[model samples]
Each structure stands twice: as structure tokens, then as C-alpha cells.
Target: MPVHNSDIAEAFRRLADLLEIEGGNQYRVRAYRNAAATVEGLPHDAARMIEQGADLSELPGIGEDLAGKIETLIETGELPLLEEVEGRVPEGLAEITHVSGIGPKRAWKLYEELGIETIEALRKAAEAGEIRDIEGFGEKTEQNIIDALGRFEGGEKRLRLMDAEHIAEPLLDYVREIDGVKQAIIAGSYRRQKETVGDLDILVTAKRGSDVMDRFVKYDEVDEVVSKGETRSTVVLQSGFHVDLRVVAEVSYGAALFYFTGSKAHNIVVRKRAIDRGWKLNEYGLFEDNERIAGKTEEEVYEKLDLPFIPPLLRENRGEIEAAENGELPDLVQLDDIRGDLHCHTKWSDGKFTLREMAEAAKDKGYAFLGITDHSKSQTVAGGLSEDGLAKQIDEIDELNEELDGIRLLKGSEVDILENGKLDFSDNILAQLDYVICAIHGGFNLSREKQTERVLRAMDNKHFNILAHATGRLINERAPYEIDLDRIMTEAEDRGCFLELNAHPNRLDIDDARCKMARDMGLMVPIGTDAHSINGLETMRFGVAQAGRGWLEAKDVLNTRAPDELLKLMRR
Candidate 1:
């Protein structure tokens, strides 16, 4: 097995978890966690670098000792130190930490008080009313544990799209480098640019007697080969993602791609249409009485069915086929249509780069403008700015605007909407900026009506221009708190404020369904990266992909307009 960067990262993370549970040195545990983060976020394969005999210590956050451990894991697929730590700590206790609201300390406490080292044990304890008797746990905490356990049993967790890309792209490149490969693509939800994917479907056209399957199973990241055949194979990557590869003839490549790249609902509707036309559609080709009609290209497949071609992103069975039949399909938003970013951070708060650096990075990306919307005083953990601090930064931005050319900076703040629905800063202070991005950072446990009302009252403020991360969801980590989105959308439309499609991978909060709803309500949506670093700006592409999935066009996105037009809309 090839130890990819993620594998090494996971090992380090597990080591840190075990060490923390064992009550080891706090700083040492933190070092391992930070090293894991840095390794996981690397743009290239660290394992490949090790293969080439590169020095791992040069990588960020990886010291000499950590580098040696990484090399050992890559070389042996095992870390003796991690194994020893596992010996001391109950491995199931680590699993307990995965439950929402159960941190390392909490897991340790559970093990100490109840001998509950596994999820099943914890659930059993909670259900039997044994957990409520423990210190710091009551009826509500016990119920929360039970609820989280139920959610865990509901389904296998899915990977974020970007993480899937990290695994798939390198594997695709390796496949294309094979001796007889001709064409290749990663199909399924990845092709549709879905927010998360269950697995990857890879399709390839190869020459006769090609060794693509052999090559695929032999890849370094293949932790397990579930099945392998001449034309099709399924393998589990080291990162726990399953991949299915199919080697199809060139003649049937198009049909195979279409068949595999589906929202099952979309595929069902398309197949029904073909059947109504006296044609059979499957992975091989579109057929009439065993004679192939069309299969070489997706365009031809759609043409044979007398329907316009549909972009993969729009194939969600959400009236897209009907719209295509009537020639009413939207001109979906593309990556190039965005003109600027309306919400990003800088060194002024929690961002990684300085203001000038962020501006230069945005300018390099051909953006006409960028907004510096750091957190307000409430997010002190993120170094949120005080009123006086914001005043000075506003002046600094004005100075940068005069010095800079080709790009403009908008002074703004990601102001917190307090529990009672007041902006973090006063109206007079907020009015000094070009715009504001109001958000909820705390009090996620409020009731649906109160949460909705809190947001409604905040949006009622004149300075509340955009609602950031409307639901405050963190994909696999946290569920969106209870809130009625319909009333919020209605309020946003009537108030002239916009909603943000936050582009961060963890929080694509205003999901596709909500984006369509906002569009239908005739509200402008801004695709903000909520970026904190230079590389973070590139997350805009992910945002655009999400917008495309939502059936949005350039006209529906606020930041697609030129700076003057965007400012004019803001002033409205």
C-alpha cells in the first residue's frame, strides 16, 4: 500500500487523539495535530516526495522528529509509537470522540466514570439513564448523545468534494500515463460538482488488450481491491473512499459516461424518455432492436432523444429535463462570470495574509474588487476587531484604495448578530463601511422561531447587506441549527439584503436548494469565499460549482457585476 499524505496525516491525528486521551503533554499533542493539518493540506503527494528521497522536514509544521515518523510510516505502513500509545489508551475511547459534543476530555471522563469506551457502550449507558447520573451530564446531554448515535447509524459519512478530488485527480493522472489508455474521466457526483460525494466513478476508453485494470489495482493508494475484472474494478483508497473504474470501448465510452454520471433520479427520467421513443438506453449505447443509434458522444446521445444537451451540474431531476425540452434551461453560472469577492478576511483579523497581500492576490486573479470583512469584536478568538481597530482599518483601506490600481477594496466587517438580534457594532460605526456581512457565531441552540426571529431582526438593520453562512452548517461535524429558511428568505427579499453562498469547503451553508429558492424569490446572491488566506481565494471555484448546481446564472449572483454596479446595489 502506498501511504498518501492523508494516510500519514490520519496516523498523526490518531496519535494525537490517543496521547490527549492518555493525558500526555498538551503541547506535544497539539504539535501532532498541527502537523497533521499541514500535511493533509499539502498540494502534492508527500509519499511520492519521500519516494524521491526529498527531505520531509522542510515541509511546514514538520520538524525533524515528525519527519522521521512520517518516513517510518511511509516505509513500513506502521508507526511503533502510535502502536504503543494505542496500547495504553482504549482505542474505542478514540471512537467515542467522534460523537458530536464529545471531546477528548469528555471521552476520557466517560471511560473513567462509566467504563464506556465504545459508541455502543455509550449509547447503552445513555439509554439506560446511567449517563445522566455522571458529573457534568444531565437529561439533555444524555438525549443529545442518543440523538448523535442515531444519526451516526443513519448512513456512512460522505467525503467533501474537494477531498474526493484530491484522491481522484492523482489517480486519474496515473491512469492516463498508462501504456494503452486513450481517454479518461471521473464521473458520478464529482462530474456534477455535488457538494459531497459517496464515491468516485471513473470511466476510461482504452486500446484493445490494455492493462488499465492491472495498473489501477497496482496504484500506491489502493488499500484494498474489492473486485477486479478485465473491464471493471472496484478498489478502496487508503483514505477510506471507494472507487469504481470501468474500461469501455471507444464506441460505448459516451454512453458509459452518461450512465455512470447520474443523479439516479435524473438517469431514470432520461431512460424513460428514450424508452418512449422506442429506444433502449444503457451503459453500452442507445439502441433500437439491437442496432446502435448513438453512443460516441454525450451531445449525440441527447440529440438522438430530441433533447438539448444538459450540463452535468443541472441534472438533478429538478425540472431540468422539462426545461431543456422547452428550451428554457438556464445559462448556468460559470467560474469566469464572477467579477469580485464580497467577503474575505485579512491579517486584520483571523486571515493568513496582510491586506496588501490579499489585494494583490485578488488582483492577480483578475478580480475588480475585494471586500475585507474581518470578524467584529464578538469573535475574539479569531482576533475580531474592536470598534477603534475597525475605524483604523477602514482608514487603511481608504489609503490602500488610493495607492492600488486595477483593484478596489471595500471596508466591511462580518458583524455578529447578537442573541437579541442586534449587530455587533452600533449603526453609526457600521455606517462608516462600504458594506456589512452579518452572521450568527454563537447561540446555535436557540429555538427555531427565536433563531429565525433573531436573524430577521438583524437583517432589519440598514447595514445588514448580506447574511453569511445562513445555516451555520459544518458538513460532517455539525448539523445546521433549527431555523426556518423560508421566512428568512422572504425577509431578505423584502429588505433588499442579499444572502451569501459561503465558498469554504466545510461550510457551503446556503446549499443548492436554498440558492434556487433565493433566486426564485428574486434576491441577489453573493458567492463569498469567506477566505482567510491567499490560497483561500481559489475556493471561489467551488462556490461557482455550487451555484451552477443550484441553477443560478450570472444575473442571479451579486458579485458578478462590476464594482460600480455592485456598490450601487449595495446602496439600495
Candidate 2:
């Protein structure tokens, strides 16, 4: 019996293979693949859809012949064609084909000649000479298999966001072509803009899937096309991310997307909680032992779980689960809730925009004020401003404030916290401005204990009002230096220092989990776009989404306060 989530698709795929193995008509073999996608995408269980008399012919490729076969599967418990296919094709071939570099032709050759089946067996054979002996197999193929094994090394592994996107776009585009497709989107970490993404999961809604299976295989971008079915299909993007496109009816699109775009841990916690109350949770709709309960969209998914629908950015094994279960998810934060930006560079140091241009951009963004934090004297690589440069920038800012219509600009520095717990700019240089956002630009080799201490001491500098990019993590480029987030959050909170939620997509640092924890600790969180240019200001929306994931409300944000109020907090 098919048991996996992707089973229905797998079943039809097998039928297609059996057609070839039995030397059946090519069109006849294609029917099984077509029917599989239709079955997979009905928005309800395939067995249930069949029992309710939903016509498989609604799918484009499925006609009387294949529809009858699918009806038999639900009614009789077996397919004559499936049995023949199983007999002729080795059971292990489907899984073997799942590996990145392997295909049915290679899988067939391995099974027929070398008797290779499971991924492990194939790995072993490839490592040895079993695969090399195949007609087309060579060292290159062997190396590719080895690389594939490494790619799939960890359980439910993760990938870079760029890698995940490369796979998702093509599949999402194809999903819209399914007979019933009405809307489509990519959800989960990929949507959340997480740096390291797992497999690409897409959300889709369709009205007719009878034609779905046939259309998916026809997508121009799909490569090494392995299997096609009525409701769904697994295709390898040229980029090597395995995308499984799911088809569901328009009514259930929202719920299905919620289920598929999950942090598995988040879903498990919600599902178990539902089961505790005699409700079943799944992609289609929440059920009370097979009775329709709630589900039409993502909101329903959370409502059924007895919590508000959380956004994609907030689903990572963060505190959202606990917050939701407790009926205490923070009030949703909106993009407009942010009133000021605390981390920005000006051409006075590393930024491209002049002080007036930066202030004008902030006004355009409707911000009450903007913090112009240029590099301090120590970071000369950024053309760091020396004392005289700081004085000149301050004079320029004061003149701009006098002449400018609205947005007020504050002079500050992204000052380096030197190795020995000292700031790059002196008190004279710091006090001449409105605020300071001290940061760690280097010295990552210090012990976690010393690094934490160095930052805490910097926080004590009365002139330094914000801790910018606290972890100094740069997504795929840099690892978060070994500092204790718990300790860092505590110190920042105790001292009333603003914690930066850097909005650089590469550094959504102090991510939602830490962000939630910071909220729990009653720490002040400032959502900063850390814009290097005008285009970067848009990144604040991502930070707002992240804040929502942490269950933070407008009141919970530091910059949400009026400029006068914010200044009071920074001064204190």
C-alpha cells in the first residue's frame, strides 16, 4: 500500500513504468502517469474522492481507460496493471530514481543487470564497480552519485535559499497549468527569506486536475523528468532541487499550502494538539475522524489549531508554536508599525546616498526619523570618518534638519567595539551626535565568554543607544560567532539597549526564535532595514514579517515609539 505523503504520485508513476516493463502501448503507459497526478491533486484523499464520485476524467489526460483503473484501486484494492508493473520492475527502482543523478533508464539497467535497488545498494554498487559496468556508466556518473549521496546526507536536510528558489519557480509555474489551478505561491522558509532553506514547497489551488499530470511533465524547465501523474509529479529542476508539485481544489488551497510549507516540528506540535481534542490535521482540511471540520485557507489551518494563522517567516521551530498553543501569539505587527531606522550608512562613511538624499528617502518611506550611522575611525576600509569628518557630518545634518521639510536626520556611527571593550570613537566624538549604534565589525576569535563581555561593556557606553547586528552573522557567508544569545538578550534588555533585527536578507539575524525569546525577556527590538542604499529600505517589510512571527505587537517594538519617545529611551 502507498503510505508516504508523495505516495499517490508514486503509485501512478509506477503504473507508467509497468507499462514500459510489460511492453504495453506507449500511450497506455502515459495514461497511468497522467491519472496519477489527477489522483494526487483532488484536494481530498484519492480514495475518498473516488468514493464521492469525483470524476477522474476532470483531469485532462485521464480518460475512461485510466479512470476505470483508478476507480478499481479504490473499490477493489488492487490494479491488474500495477501488479504486472511491480512484477516486471523491481520495487527498489522508484527510490533509486529519487537520487539526483539517477534516472529510470539507469535504474532499469541497474536492476536488470546488477540487481541494484535501494539507495544504499546503489551507493555501494557505484562505489564498487556495479554501476561502472553499465553501458553508459562511467567515473563521472559515479562521482555524480557520490555527490548526490552527500546532498541527501542529513535527515530532512536544509539548503541555501537561492538553491531552493531555483527549484521552486519552475514547479510553481507548472502547478498553475494543472486543470483546476486557480492560485499558486511558494511558502515556508523560502517565502520567509530564510538564508538556509530546506526542500522547496509550493502552494497551489486548481479546479480540474484530470489534465494536471500531462501538463506538468510538459513544462519547459523540468529536467530528467522521472514521473508524472494526475494530481502531482516529481521533477528535477536543472538546479537539482527535487520539486513535488501538489494539486488541490481551490477550496482547500490555503490549508494545503499551510501543511506543505511547514517547519515539520511546527506541524507536528499543532497536529498532536489537534489529535488530543479528537481532531485530525492534514493538508486538505482539519477533520474530526473524517468529518469536515475547518479549512479553506491558511487562517483556517491556524484557527483549527486554536491559534491565529502565523506567517511563513514565523514557522521555524520558533516560539510561535508555544505562543499559539497558549492563545497568546503577539498581536500581528504591520509594515507601517516601524517609525525609524537605526542602522544606515551615509556616503560620509560607507553609504552611497548623501545626507540629504538619505533623509529624503526616509521621508518618502514615511519614517519619522533616520539614523545616519557611518563607520567609526577604526573601520578605515569603509572610509571611516575621523573626528573632523564626524564634526563635518554633524554640521551637515544640522543644516539639513533646518532646511528639510519633514524627516529629521540623526547623526550616529556604526562604531567598532575594539578588542578590549572600547569604542572606536571617543566620547567627544559620540556626544556631538544624537545617538550611536555600536557594532562588532571584527575580532571574532574571542571566546564566547569574552565576546559576550566585550559587547555588554560596549552597551554600558551611555552614548551607544543600539546594538547593531548583534551576532555579526552574514548568512551563507559568515557563521554567527559563538556568543550566547540568552546572555546577549539579557544584557541588552537590562541596559535598555535596542537590539537590531538586521533586515539584510542574508542576515535576518536575531531570527524569529531569538526575537520571540527577546520579547519574552522584555527586551526592546528595533526592526532595521540596515539599508546600504535606497533600494534596501524595502527590506523592512521582511523584518516586520519576522517580528510578527515572533508574536510581537507594535507596542513591543522600540522604533514604534514616537521619535521624541524613542529619543528618551535612547538617552536613558
Question: TM-scores of the models, in the given order?
Answer: 0.90, 0.67
Residues 1-572, candidate 2, lDDT per residue (tens digit)?
21211244556777776556445677666566545544432333555456677776655456777777666765555668678768767776766665655656777777778878777787788778656667887877777677666544323435544334434554676677666667778766677666666556555665542566667667655666677766667777544556666667666776677787787887888888789998888888888887867767878767776787776766766677776678766677788788878778777875656788888889998989988888888988567999899999899889888998878887777889988888988898889887788888876646689989898888778887788888877554345665776877887777777778887665777777777787777887888877766655766766777777676788888888777888887785
Most lDDT-accurate candidate:
1
Clashing pairs in 1: none
**How many steric clashes does model 2 contain?**
19
TM-score of 2: 0.67
Local distance difference test scores for all models: 0.87, 0.71
Clash numbers, per candidate: 0, 19
Measured by C-alpha RMSD in angstroms, how accurate is candidate 1? Answer: 3.0
C-alpha lDDT (0 to 100) for residue 483 of candidate 2: 77
lDDT of 1 by residue, 1-572 (tens): 66776678778989999998888998899789867756755556677777788898976457799999998898889999999999889998876876766879989999999998988888899989998888898889888787767655223578877667777888999999998999999999999988888898999988898889999999988889999999899999877889999999888888888999998899999999999988999999999989999988888899999888999999899999999999999999888999899889887887767899999999999999999999999998678999999999999999999999999998889999999999999998998999999999887667789999999999888888999999888776577877999989888888888889999877887999998888778888899988776767888888999998888999999999998899889874
